[model samples]
Target: MRFERVWWGALSLLAASPAWAADGYSVLGDWPVKATSESGIEAGLKGNLSYDVARFGGADGGAFADDDAWRRQELSAFVRKPGMFELALGYDFRNEVWLDNFVRISGAAGDLRIGQFKTPVGYEESAVSTTATTFMERALPVTAFYAGRRLGADWTYEKIPNWYLNAAVQAGGDLLGDNRGRTLGARAVFNPVKDENQVLHLGLSASNEKRDDDSLRLQVRPEAFLAARRLVDTGALNRVEGIARYGVEAIWQRGPLLLQSEYLRIGVDRDGVADYSADGYYLAASWVLTGEKRGYKSAAFGNLKPRRDWGAVELAARYSHIDLDDAGVALGGRQRDWTFGANWYLGQHFRLQFNYVWAEARRRGTGLDPQIAQLRAQIYF
Candidate 1:
């Protein structure tokens, strides 16, 4: 929620359009050791560290217990001298103690970041929850669009070579007005199932937000009050004043079992008076009972690697759900949740996480609505 100075000079004057390279980078799940050459200095440093704790309750008197911590403390020293140029700085802290403080400049084709980032939506809220997602909480429609650093500019393109594409646009600050108006996004990833160990994956995404007064829109769940008064008589609150989203994701690991899933949808129209919509999805499975062989990026799904072994241990489970409504436009109130989770890895980098959550609510007269049970422990570095 920070990023000013003419929004960082309008993302440093837009127009650079093309740069993509994420398929590797980890800390709690290992990886991150690349620096054999490029002129040492440990090849310009690297980073990762995390800590988590969670507890939950609700029966009528919602329960409590929460303690969270995370730190990224800077890295990425130098690279220039005509060799793919680079420079980066950091300092991340979170616990409500969410501090960003960043700087970046990359190359090889493109890169020019400028602090407070992370908000591309879908695919487990853009992954990186201490490492390679396996659930420790993140589903509820991707944590209801939780946000990350604020100021932004991210672009990438790969004009066919293995296929890749990305885009990010932003404007920070604003929950009501003053200048909280833009947010557009895009992402596309393809591998089409290459070989070696296994490969087959696909991804797609979209986003649109002009928020300041739509309050993230989409309300009207009082068990559907005449579709929210006929969407407030047709105009749908000036065509859902603002907020739009889209998503899709899939995976298929070739060995040791690892599958994945994702789907999202959101919309709200207030300018037309009131209209709403909502969506959600999830499905997961993991297994590496000591037979190892889960590479291709450590198996989250397809890229290849279905066999191997070591002290190796992998086990995971997941189920998720969500829904929203306001067809009659009485304005917001209808919720759902049914989650289950588990994960453990002792080899990749470090891993241990847990989850047991359940939630449900309905509001029309506020009765028989309230239930929650949560528990979580996650550590990454």
Candidate 2:
């Protein structure tokens, strides 16, 4: 019911608005709501909302076990001055928590970022935004191994030609006061071939995390939005001391086609038991049917832009795999997912996405295969 209301509301908004091409890269343009002063201070509203619906078949138990919901993804506002600094504070409706509340200062050398933000990890985990991803959700390996937002400070240096480097130290937890531990992470990317019509990007990342106690769990959904259940979960392994994670990423883009792949490995150190390890990887490809080339910036791919009045069309496919069973632990399970997606970019602020997913999970010598179909309506300003 909630999903239906939000879905309708988004459609209504799209229908009521005039079909005007967005100005440059700003979706809202210079609206009356924004203010700019002589001192270079600028303030405006920023928010993104998405409603997702999904149907699942051949699943034993999970949120996607024939269920759907409307999710309030992100809501935020920001204040900034060009080339000086910016501050943004927002909330994530999906997790019902605070979003990226951070301040960044830029200079010739690099940028200094502070407050609660995402850790420098994998390409999909930290480099890309939810609104710009090619798929409805990120790959399972990224979600399982990469650290999300945390209270921390990060430094980014992109002065090197065709290269980007970032490092950060963060507190492991959300803003709601659930302090988990601490983490240190970094990422480096180099674009060997950067051109107007083609790009080849290679990147690597690593992170070390120390947990407060033995309780640590890693899990992920089967690449389906609104799937409340994680098909693979490494339920709270006790006496865990620390964790180390590593990742490698590569992306190649030519004309309207884009290819991306990443691999992640994690090692958990237990107090008295032998260290356990898990790994996952994914490969994805996307193409713009309307011939609009996908944008790339800061070692990540941006959103698609429509050239014609009818808007832009994109088709994407991805395959991901994760293994959580190791040594004496066989409870988390191993899973593989294949997803196909189609997207319609109705201007810059609105989009319609559809995805079909096939997932197979094996645990304790038993296997379960589930198929899911999902649709999403997204709006941002």
Candidate 3:
């Protein structure tokens, strides 16, 4: 990406801003480079590193099976014209997935984004930043229905207070060069109440998709990305033609406690078979024990910032279920999960997390259960 060339003269520019200068920065420390040109242009780097280790147990035979990995290693650099627009290039080294490589324009017409970025299909998927997800991973429905990252364009409108609208079109393939499908999505959000100590967000979304091939696979890793296989899998729907996705999400925060939920459904049109359908939903609540609240903006919850030098501590729990059985599609099965988690935000940019999950999956009357515990050390800037 010739990133070095982009920052070749960063030292001189950054040195001009004595107020913005920091002692050190990087994945391991502070944000090293942040500078503004004399003409009001801003340039800087962004990165997020998440390292995970897990232990699997229970009667599922997954016991004694353990794995560790660099869950995500992503870095990006951006140059922006304050209040006007910005250009950013990013990539995830661990998954070899492209992050935000796009051109964003801001003005009276609202935000018009082009290039590779996330599609505004679901509330959690579109609004919540990956670095700030409530848990190690999102709920089942979100993971299965949301279009990750695609080569396309997205438009967002928020000219009216407390109301947001977004629509996007995607073609070709995903960032990883997979899911070669054409997609279109739209979402609308309304914040009935927003104040210093309370906020309520309501949202609805819908999407249509068509893949290059007639075969489609829908699977989800059991709330633990480190797992090698998906316990509930719909191998490959051989006669699929088109797909439709829909979702409803809501979030309410009062003081240090937050409540959130989402329901997502997907429908498939098969050639010789009846239309198939699946749905999933989750309910979660979190409380910040250190008297800190997560910030809210752009229709999403921002990462929590520590108020104390020792940082912030949070406790959360969630229950989720996904049903992939419908229209004679029996083998896809269904899964129900319960997860308890704790997060310790050491600073604005570093965090430690732990999660315990109990997953129950069934297909054609047979069941599989597993207990998993995982930990993550993450840093972001």
Candidate 4:
């Protein structure tokens, strides 16, 4: 009933919006809003809901039973001004929700962001969650060693008209379960040319974390609280892990051919004496069969698209790899994926996506290679 009410309210709002006019219904302002004009604080909401279907098979196409299907939902609200700041709030289906990338005020060319947000160390790492690569999963190395997201402050500079730069520092966790714990990290990006038709971007980032003993106590379920305490008392818990990440991506679009590539490296600080490092990258090209815009972000280019349009369509593919063992704890693994995807635009306030991934993972231990395939669909505004 609660969900129905929300839906009904949204429908009514859309019906009465200026977007509806007197003709009929339009996709614009269907539910949430988008940043259209840069007047007073421009505010809007966005959402993502995707269905993930996975199938696990061995190299020979035999099935594995551990695979299952799941659904994911995310909602976010953002407010941005042309001047000094932006605020965002988001909720993910994983029982986790917080201020997405709340940034503080900074000087002329630099701004600071704080809170739980994706790391700035990698190029794609900063892509809006809903507008990322594949839905069911990210790239291989991005999954294996990428630290996902952490609480931190980010700084960015765009003093030069056609050039931009960014840096960040983050805290990893709460002191224990109470939110006093933290992690430390930083990242920087340099863009030499920034234009609608051409651009060039390059970046580097890294971070380290020290876990809190108290926060460690709360990671377990209530049922295992006693066990957690026991492990802590015996010092059997692996308490420390630090992560370092670096990546660069370049994207270019000329006439109708769109090309992009990302190179990344990750190092992990684990317990005991076992350490690990891995590197992976992808080079992809796409053709806008219909002369549509293929907006992409990279070391060479960032978001590129013109306003006013019914919509646009793009088809793309990518290849990726990762190897996670240097000191031999045996976490070593690699994967390759052949992906086909499409993007649809419903004015500035809506986007729809579809992707199919044919992937295979190779593991070091059993000399077994597992093949997996998945499909994902998402809507964002």
Candidate 5:
């Protein structure tokens, strides 16, 4: 409680800063701590803190402990010369993992980056920022079946108009030294109708990974972080040596309205056993109530900028489903969820989000359905 009190005090001061009212206040360009040198190098320090103020009913009945909404607390430091080169380091106080400590070099050949970065898959799973997602938590599908961050080398090319390509090779493990696997991944995107007010985009991604130990466990909450137990779970499946994942994504944005969808399928290859498969998908839509459009940059979606200094408001809905039962492997079972969300952006550095999830999961002839409500307070820079 004392730590939370101190954090809240700090947030109050940031909320009163005059800098957040500037027209240049941007999710990527503006920082709470920024400076520039005569040599034309820029440096910045940024961070975010998000937590659930309260949770009610639903899956979080204090059944499994940890019924708090302490989502994330992260800080990042970066130095760059315009866009030609940049170095960044990020750390998560809550998860105890290195986020994006990487070096990036840009040229006519596109961009090359090496370090701990995202693996270039799953759109909603990789929202530009933790605080920028349309909902307080990511959809169930993305959470259940995606390789999040990894230590790796990646290359990207966007010289061709309306086209983007990314290739990456990952080894070692995540910054936490878990899931030590060798993975090769690639993604391609085509944005045909790109303009100020209208856009259409399609993307495909695939990855193949081999682990030192052939085992995997898949589980996820019911679209609520404060939920005590994961509704669907595959305790542990061993014998598999490799995994292959394929995904397809699409997005259409028109003014203040945006529609997006994604599908992910995975194949688990086991030793002396039949391969098993799993799949999941989600559909999401959002409408900005204050005439602001969601930001899009570098093949990713970002937060919306308010046309007025008063800030922006958005309404969103998502339907997500995941099926982990394949062949005789029915450990995780199937889950379907419907989530309705509302977000209020209070200037550049703060926002408030609320979500209600209706979820149902069936496993081993047993079914669980819960209606949950949660609210989150966020501060980021």
Candidate 6:
């Protein structure tokens, strides 16, 4: 009922709003009002909304037969000045209402940012924005191991050509409260080849976290957009003291073809119990049928652009696997997923995506295979 209301409300708002301009944003709709003082202070408003729907089948039971939801991914405003110092505040209307705020300072050497932002851990998790992902949802491995938004301070150094470094220290909970834990993470990326026609990126990332009184749980869905039930869940492990995660990623692009892969390992330490570890990896490839190559910046892939009046079309496929059973725990099940996706870029701010997923999982001597199909309509300003 509430989800339906929000979904319809977002649709109504989008329909009532003015159309977007060629540059992909309307001065009146996107940057409705912007002002610059003589001292170089500037301010503006920004927001985006996304809606997702899904149908599930082939499961032992009707786990996720049908589901849908609308999310106000980002509704925020920002203020900035000449020295590249800025402040931003927003709310994320996902499953829960939460505040998203941050500050940034830039100088000759590097940039320092403090805010509630996504942690830098995996290539795909850090690179692709939610509004512009190739698939309806991220891979299962990424969802299981990667840390989402956290209140933290991060530093980035990219003054050296073709080299980038990022480091951060963050609280594991949201601004409203904190009960999860604290984390420290770092990443380094080097681009040996960068050009208009080709790009190659190699990166490594690691994180260390101190758990808060055995409250950590690891789980993931079957790469479905609207399904809420996780096929694999480690239900709250006991006496968890700490966790460490490591990842390696690579991306290669030539012309309109792109290939990417990443591997992640997470180790958990417990009190009076044998330590255990879990790992996962994924491989994906995409091709732009409209001859518009995906853009690469700051070690991540940006959104696709339409090259013709008909718009841009992209086809993508992925294979992902995650194994959570280790020396002491067997509850977290193991899963393998194969997904095929298509994306259509009507313009810079409007996109439609479709995905079909086949997932297989084994737990406690039982096996289940599920199939899911999902669609998404996204609009942003």
- Identify the runs in model 3 with alpha carbons over 4 angstroms from their true place: 1-32, 61-64
True lDDT of residue 339, candidate 5? 94
RMSD of 2: 3.3
User: Over the stretch 39-107, how does candidate 1's per-residue lDDT look in tens digits?
Assistant: 543344444454444343456323233333332332233333333434444443332223333444546
**Model 3 C-alpha lDDT versus the unseen true structure:** 0.82
Lowest summed lDDT window (length 10), candidate 6: 25-34
- Superposed Cα deviation of residue 277, candidate 5 (Å): 0.5
Better of 4 and 5 by TM-score: 5
The sequence of per-residue lDDT tens digits that candidate 5 reaches over residues 142-231 is 887778788899999988999889999999888888879888999999998899988898999999988877788888888887676788
Q: What TM-score, over all chains together, does every model reach? A: 0.30, 0.90, 0.90, 0.71, 0.90, 0.88
lDDT for position 362 in model 6: 84
lDDT at position 64, candidate 1: 31
Which portions of model 2 show Cα errors greater than 4 Å? 1-34, 58-64
lDDT, residue 308, model 4: 38
Better by lDDT, candidate 6 or 1: 6
Write down the RMSD of all candidates, one decimal each.
20.8, 3.3, 7.0, 8.1, 3.8, 4.1
**160-202, model 3: which lDDT tens digit per residue?**
9999999999888776788788989899999999999999999
Model 6 Cα lDDT, one tens digit per residue, 176-280: 665467989999999999998999999999998885667568889888856667778777787788888999999999999999899999988888887778999
lDDT of 2: 0.82
lDDT of 1: 0.49
Q: Show model 4 residue runs off by greater than 4 Å.
A: 1-24, 28-39, 54-71, 99-103, 106-109, 132-136, 172-182, 212-241, 269-274, 294-311, 344-354, 365-373
